[model samples]
Target: MNITLLEAELRRDEGTKYSPYIDSTGNQTIGVGRNMKANPIPKDWTFPLTDAQVNQLLAEDIQTACASLDRFLPWATAR
Candidate 1:
């Protein structure tokens, strides 16, 4: 339940490129960027990202990838 760890995972997966902003009300907005600069914010959106939203997104990702760990370090666990 660490925010830093979740942020690290989000950063690793390029969360900034996807649902960048955590929104003012704990909601995620996708494809909010426009232009070569790859703006990470939406026009109608407001500032301030809540810890809940950011953590939620990262947590969901971690959950989805949980099964992928089985394939990792397989040789060591193989019997």
Candidate 2:
């Protein structure tokens, strides 16, 4: 599976949000449906990140997700 394609699908499905909101399970989330509980912010992190910051976080989160996929489905990355 292509990581870029996977990321695009995730972005399309999850959508993007600049502001934080509570997810269905009562977890705080921000930036492309990232769960705060799963992806905790730094202790010194602040709320209301700028659009660029939000994009940066989304990119980071996507990378994290791809890493997890690689770990769980090593064959997915095989040619």
Candidate 3:
């Protein structure tokens, strides 16, 4: 899979963000609208992530998404 393309699409669709914010449904979200419920932060995690941290979070989210896709569509790995 083209992770660069996937990241581009995610940024285009979800919109990149550096600071933590409450989403429409009131979930604490950050780094391209990553839902805290689905991707929990460390117990000591803080708000207002730096640019590097935001990028790291986006990378982690991308990995998680890819894993999910692989699990649901095993044939994707054969491509």
Q: Pick the candidate with the highest TM-score.
A: 3
Tens digits of lDDT, candidate 3, 1-79: 7888878888898887776779889898888878978787666767677777778888998788778878998787667
Query: Clashing residue pairs, candidate 1?
Result: none
How many angstroms is residue 31 displaced in model 1 relative to the true structure, after the best TM-score fit? 11
TM-score of 1: 0.33
Best by lDDT: 3
Task: List the pairs of residues colliding in candidate 2.
Answer: none
**Looking at model 2, which ten-residue stretch has the lowest summed lDDT?**
41-50
lDDT, candidate 1, at 75? 57
Ranking by lDDT: 3, 2, 1
TM per candidate comes to: 0.33, 0.72, 0.78
lDDT of each: 0.46, 0.77, 0.81
Candidate 2 clash total?
0
User: How many residue pairs clash in each candidate at the backbone level?
Assistant: 0, 0, 0
